[model samples]
Target chain A: MGRIKTTNNQISRREIIIEKAATLFKEKGFKAASMREIADVVGVEAASLYNHIKSKNELLNIICFDVANRYTHKMEEVEASKLTTLAKVESLLRFHIDGMVNHFEEVYVSDREWKHLDNPYLSNMQNQRRTYRKRFAAIIEEGIKKKEVKKIDAATAVLIMLHAIGGIESWHRSTRKIIGKELEENMVTFLIDGLRKI
Target chain B: MGRIKTTNNQISRREIIIEKAATLFKEKGFKAASMREIADVVGVEAASLYNHIKSKNELLNIICFDVANRYTHKMEEVEASKLTTLAKVESLLRFHIDGMVNHFEEVYVSDREWKHLDNPYLSNMQNQRRTYRKRFAAIIEEGIKKKEVKKIDAATAVLIMLHAIGGIESWHRSTRKIIGKELEENMVTFLIDGLRKI
Candidate 1:
């Protein structure tokens, strides 16, 4: 019971660090955001921060890979579902927008600051990203083959959907007159409708 | 004749500095890139860089505003043209893709690095950007009224187009498999076809 309590404390403490780090990373960028600053935000001594994480890069790796893993895992579930290609595309678009809305800092940092990651990890992240995109394009290819989607280039379509959803980063900063549900619906109509065969 | 030669030399020298600065800014980011490093790339002494530009911020301003002016000017021409609304959108899309292909570094730096500009200039650039987007949206609005465009929200449509095109930066780094013209045509079909009234 004592060990369980200690483990729970450790997990929550780590979560706090990551939550603070994401904000700093998003605001100042990964290169400019310091671990000490993150610790300060978390109300922990800089020295204590090392007890939970090894280095700044480790914190970054946790945030980036955490977001990447969520995406990949979601895609796997999506692939396993019985939904039609158009429905699957809608699911994916909803997932992307919901991720941006709920975890704006983590998603934004993962999208923008992944470049600051170092060697082996950087290449590994890139591989994961490329694989994810390939799988996404494969879905579009399937749609085209099944006559569900138009004959447009699958890679280009995937790029359009992904990047267009990423534009929600601006919406997050704007007056946001368009609420989240409306934005998602508009985007889905704009993208999925664009992919549908005439 | 002497005065004309001096003016030409000044213009060419300034162009060289801005070109080199754009490359460096794109690589290292505006804040991280040094004027000395930029001067190094231009084969000039660090001190001599100031003879051509007042500061690094000035260099960034020139690159950003130059691209913005090109875009705003092109939009003005498109607005004044006799083309249908669909044709105007096609022209705008073509202009955006062509700018990315031809002036990749400048456009990338302007899009990514303009946030680093100091105040007055920052707000000024923001206003210019907002105005540009409003104008773009106005074109779409006109299209919808004339039944040239589907009744999608014009702001969302503009966001989709611009951000989708920005994803070409990834293509610029990736394998050269999809050539520029093909990419533009594919994108045009994907975006414009979606916007056409059924």
Candidate 2:
């Protein structure tokens, strides 16, 4: 029972570290944030932080890949769904909006700090990103072929949708008077409606 | 004659420094890049750089404000024009696209690095940004009133357009097989066409 408790404690501690690290990375950027600062924020000694996590780079890798994997997994589910192209895009946009809203710090760090990722991991993230974009564009292309979506450049359309959703980050910094649901619906109306054939 | 030649040399040298600083800031981010490195890129001694520019933060301020001023000035022109709301938006989109392509480094630095500006400058830039968004949204509101645009949340639509244009930075990282004109036209279609009242 003690051993099991220890393992559970370790898992939660690691999560706490990642949460703190995400905030730091988002505020100070990955290159400028230090492990000591992360440890301080997590309420642990810098030395003990090494016991829970390997290094600052490891923290970045975990944050970046975790978010990337979430996106990839969401896209996979989106691909398998029986929804129409427009519905699929809306679903994807909702997922992105939720991620940005609920997980703003993590999502922002993943989006901006992914560039600081080192080798193997960097390439892996890039491949995952490229594949995700291709899959997204494919959905638009399918929509175009079926006359569900307007005749638009699939890649450009995909870029606009994904990037526009990222604008939620800016909204977070704004007055934020618009509630989350309203913002999501308005964005969906703007983006998905734009994609639909006239 | 010597004084006039010296003035021209100073102006050109300052331009070169800004050009090189934009590249460094884009590559290494504002906080991580150094003025000395920028001087090295421009083949000037680090001290000589001070002669041309005040400091690294000043360079960032210059790059960021220059881009912001351009956007504000363009909007001023659009506001004064007799063009329909949709045409005004299209014109603004084209300007944004061209800036992202031609002055890619400067525009990018402006978008991402503006946060590093000090107090008054930071607040000043933020005010300009807010004003710009308000003006853009007001244009859309006018469109909705005149039945020129769909009855969507003007703020949300403006956010989509600006954020979508920022996505071109991602395209610059990709294969970039899509030429500038095609990308611009496609984006204009997806965004502006969606705005047109059905």
Question: How well does each candidate superpose onto the true structure, as a TM-score?
Answer: 0.87, 0.90
Q: lDDT by residue for model 1 over B58-147, one digit each (tens)?
A: 998888989999998998999999998888888998999999988999999998778878788889899988888899989988888888
* Model 2: CA > 4 A from native: A1-11, A195-198, B1-11, B195-198
lDDT of 2 by residue, A1-198 (tens): 111122444468778788889999998888778877887777666878888888888999999988999998999899999999888988998999999999999999999888888898989998998899999999988988888888888888888888898888778988756988899988888886652224
In candidate 2, how many clashes are counted? 0
**lDDT string, candidate 2, B38-102, tens digits:** 86777766888888777788998999999999998999999999998888888998999999988
Worst 10 residues of 1 chain B by lDDT: B1-10
TM (chain A) per model: 0.89, 0.90
- For every prediction, compared with the true complex, DockQ reads 0.38, 0.44
Q: Each model's C-alpha lDDT?
A: 0.83, 0.85
DockQ, computed on Cα atoms, for candidate 2: 0.44
> Which residues of candidate 1, in runs, are more than 4 Å off?
A1-11, A34-40, A43-51, A195-198, B1-11, B43-48, B195-198
List pairs with backbone clashes in candidate 2: none
Q: Which candidate tops lDDT?
A: 2
